[model samples]
Every structure is written in C-alpha cells, then in structure tokens.
Target: MSVDLETVKRVARLARIAVTTEDAERMTGELNAILGFVEQLDEVDVSGVDPMTSVIPMVMRKRQDAVTDGNKAADIVANAPAAEENFFLVPKVIE
Candidate 1:
C-alpha cells in the first residue's frame, strides 16, 4: 500500500498533529514502508498456527468474588460533606 503526501497530511489533520510539508513528505515514505512490511507479513503461511495472547505459557490467578465491605454505607456516608438517607446529596443542575 502506497501512502501519498495528501493522505499523510489528512492523517496528520485527523490526529491533530501540527505537521509541516517536509514532515508530511517524510511521513509519506515512512508510512508506505510500514504498510509494505505489513503486506510482506500477510504473505507468510500460518495455516496451522494457534492464536496466543503471549509467547510464554502462564495461568491467571483466580480470586473469590465475595463482598468484603457490604455493610459500610453509614461509615462511607459519614465522610460526605452533604449526605442524606445514606446517599450523597448534590445540587440539581438540570431543569
């Protein structure tokens, strides 16, 4: 895939990057090189390869999903500057 100067400029605009004409020209070549490398990688044969999250094999540690602080609503509401009925009260903004 060939990246043109206009495409690079458009990408810079979309990314909110302040790019000069020289920088855009340089980026055009660099982006084209990266896309060409990806195209080359797409040509590689991986018919029987399994998808993996990481190169090293490891298992994730599991934890119990029991609640540790379920009955602390009064303690939590005590710290609030403006709380009522175990709930924090805020000024209504919407009409």
Candidate 2:
C-alpha cells in the first residue's frame, strides 16, 4: 500500500492540483497510510449485518396537504424597481 512519488504526481495532475516536490513527498506518505487503513478494513467480517439508517427507530411526522394563497401580493411588489398591473416589469429580451 505504498504510494510512490510518481503515483502522487500523477494523482495531483489528474486532480488539477499543483504540488511542490516537498509537498508531493509528504502527500505520498499520507495517501499510503490511508490506503493501508482501507486494506485493513477489508480483513473484517460483517456477514448478515443489515444496513441501518439510524441507531434509534422512530416514525416520521406527517401533516395534511392544504393549498391556499395567503395574500401577500402588496408586500411582495413593494420593493420592485418597476411594477405595472400588479406585476414586476422587466426589459423584454425575446422577439
């Protein structure tokens, strides 16, 4: 799981990152350690374990679906730079 300097340089290039020689050497060691930990995780056994969303289970809250316009047209159009016929006016861009 050792990452060489060349591999690190290639990774940096692929990621569009500029790296100095010193930083490349440091990153190679850090990346190798991370890969080693991932390799170690591969040795663990977790057969038949069910995936879980959370440790504690609870029902989600539900609400009734109601549709109604809460009249706020005056408040909404108050800050417009230009408004006509109760609607914001803008420069026409399409023919």
Candidate 3:
C-alpha cells in the first residue's frame, strides 16, 4: 500500500505532531519508500525458517514448579519487635 500526502498529514494530526505542508509532502514520499521496502520483504521465501528469540543456539533454562513456603519467613521477621511462629505480632490498630 502507498501513502499519500493527505494520509501523511492526517496521521501527523492524529499523532498530535504539528507538520507543515512541505514536511507532510516530504514524509509522504519517505513513508511510501518504507512501505515499499516492507512489501518487498513479504516476497521473500522463508517457509523453512524457524522463528527464534535469540541468534545463538541454546537450551532454555527451566526450573521445577515445586511449591514451598520459602523458609525466609523467620529471617524476615527477625527484625520485628514481636514475632511468633515466623509471623510478626502487631498491636491492634482498629478501634
């Protein structure tokens, strides 16, 4: 698809960018060039190519989904003025 001068000006206005008529005219050509390049990319044969997240071949590191209470409860409450059973005992605030 090709971009026209009006489309460029409309897009600029929608994006809240102030563009003069000359700039819009210039951007219309530039946007058309970019779209033409993207269209050319669609013509390439890439059915054999596999999509990947990284360039380097590596195994994804994974950990076990084991559930645990994360034994740091006692350590976290160590600095509290009053803590019992790995819990902080706070004074009642509501009347």
Candidate 4:
C-alpha cells in the first residue's frame, strides 16, 4: 500500500507524536519506499522452499525441571541494613 503525507500525518496523530510538516513528508517518502520494497519481494518464487529457523541444525541442551529448598534466609538477610521476621524493614510513610 502507498503511504502519502496525509496518511503519515494521521499515523503520527494516532501515535501521539508531534510531527512537523517536514518530518511528515520525510516519513511519507520512507514508508512508500518500504512498501515498494515489500511489493518487489512479492514477485519472488518460493513455492517449495523449506521453512528454517537457522542455516545450520542445532542440538539444544536439556535440563531437569525440578525445585529444591535454597534454605539461606539468614545468609541473604545478613546483607540488609535492617530486616525483621523474614522481611525487609523500612520507615513507615503513611500517617
């Protein structure tokens, strides 16, 4: 689809951007060029092309999905300036 200055202006407004007339014109030209390139790509033949994630096949490493008790609450709390009852203590803000 072709993008004109008016269309660019509408898009800028919808995106809550403050676009000057010069920027709107520039963006319109850029969007039109992008669409033109996409139209060019549409002419290529890819009927029997295989879908690929990468150029080379990869073997992903696997790991067991399990949970264990960390049991280091005192060690972790030692770093804090002030802690109470397994929680961080901060100054009260509300009246």
Top lDDT prediction, candidate number: 3
* Model 2 misplacement above 4 A: 58-95
How accurate locally, in lDDT, is each candidate?
A: 0.91, 0.88, 0.93, 0.89
Q: Give, for candidate 1, the lowest lDDT window spanning 10 residues.
A: 52-61
**Deviating ranges (above 4 Å) for candidate 1:** 62-95
TM-score of each: 0.65, 0.56, 0.63, 0.59
Give the local distance difference test score of model 4: 0.89
TM-score head-to-head 1 vs 4, winner: 1
- Comparison by lDDT, 1 against 3, better one: 3
TM-score of 2: 0.56
Off by over 4 Å in 3: 61-95
Query: Considering TM-score, which of the candidate structures 3 and 4 is the better prediction for this target?
Result: 3
- Model 2 clashing residue pairs (backbone): none
TM-score ranking from best candidate downward: 1, 3, 4, 2
Q: For residues 1-95, what per-residue lDDT tens digits would candidate 3 score against the true structure?
A: 99999899899989999999999989999999999999999999999999886899978889999999888888899999999999899999999
Consecutive 10-residue window with the lowest summed lDDT within model 4: 60-69
Q: TM-score for model 4?
A: 0.59
